[model samples]
Target: MSSFRVMRCQPLAREAGSVKKPLNHLLVSAFVYAGLGVASGLFYREFTKLNGFPEGAFTQLGLAHTHLLSLGFFPFLILLGLERAFTFSASRKRFGWFLGLYHAGVILTSAMLIVHGCLTVLGLESSAMISGIAGLGHMAITAAIIVLFLALRTAVRGVERPAAVAA
Candidate 1:
């Protein structure tokens, strides 16, 4: 009975179709980046006052924020924009595994790198750990980037091939 109620509360298939808007996603991503950038800059300034310089601690935090905002948030928005601009059919498809993988990679990598970098900077952890985290994060981000690139390429080809045939 409870399960039935939950199912009834869920959005209908048709309603779900209208929920994803590429432009809206882009705008939301832009807003998140802007907010995080401002917060990181302010935090850095505060840390400098307390430590007489931006401490390794603050730097790591700032870097994390920057990456989250720029690579994680902004790239997602950019991807959405590209999908719309290129009319990618996959964009219209349900939340796909590739999208999940891309986002998970971004979030997990960013978190690990940020925390490891911060701990190393604070002298609480070894440089080796930091390096390892950074390496892993880079690999994850690279994978995400590759996925996005492939998706974009597919979308563009779909658009271009039809136009070429028509001509």
Candidate 2:
């Protein structure tokens, strides 16, 4: 009897969860990226001021701040706004792909930047291998952007056109 009750309630819980809210990975990830950007900015300033300012750390962190905000936070913010203005279709499989890919790009690119930045602060030179890795990260970012555009274009088509009004 207890097992039957558990099974019945479990489905109800899952059903409740499936009811979509206006928020999802895309919006949540945007806010997260925003927080990360702000955090990066704060760290950038702190590192720059430490020990009479480490020049390499200062420059790399500055680039990291802008990169995180612009490439990670800003794009997602725009996507969230678009989502609110035009609700995406409930079928979210592809949107999930877009979200996953975009985040992968963001994480990849940002992590490489941080690694490169740290190496610079440590007075290490970037070898060809390091440069290749950085380039790969940038490529992921570019590919993610392309995927997002494609996804948005397809989803936007479902939005009903405004009715024409006569003069």
Best by TM-score: 2
lDDT of 2 by residue, 1-167 (tens): 22322211111112334434535656677788889888887876675566355445344546777888888878877876666554442436656666666677777777777776666655668667766776777877777667666766765665555444434
RMSD of each: 12.8, 12.3
Model 1 stretches with alpha carbons more than 4 Å out? 1-19, 54-62, 73-77, 89-98, 120-127, 160-167
Q: Candidate 2 deviates by what RMSD? A: 12.3
TM-score: model 2 vs. ground truth: 0.72
**lDDT score for residue 54 of model 1:** 45
For model 1, the local distance difference test gives: 0.56
Give each model a TM-score: 0.60, 0.72
Residue 77 in model 1: shift from native, Å? 4.8
Off by over 4 Å in 2: 1-22, 51-58, 89-91, 162-167
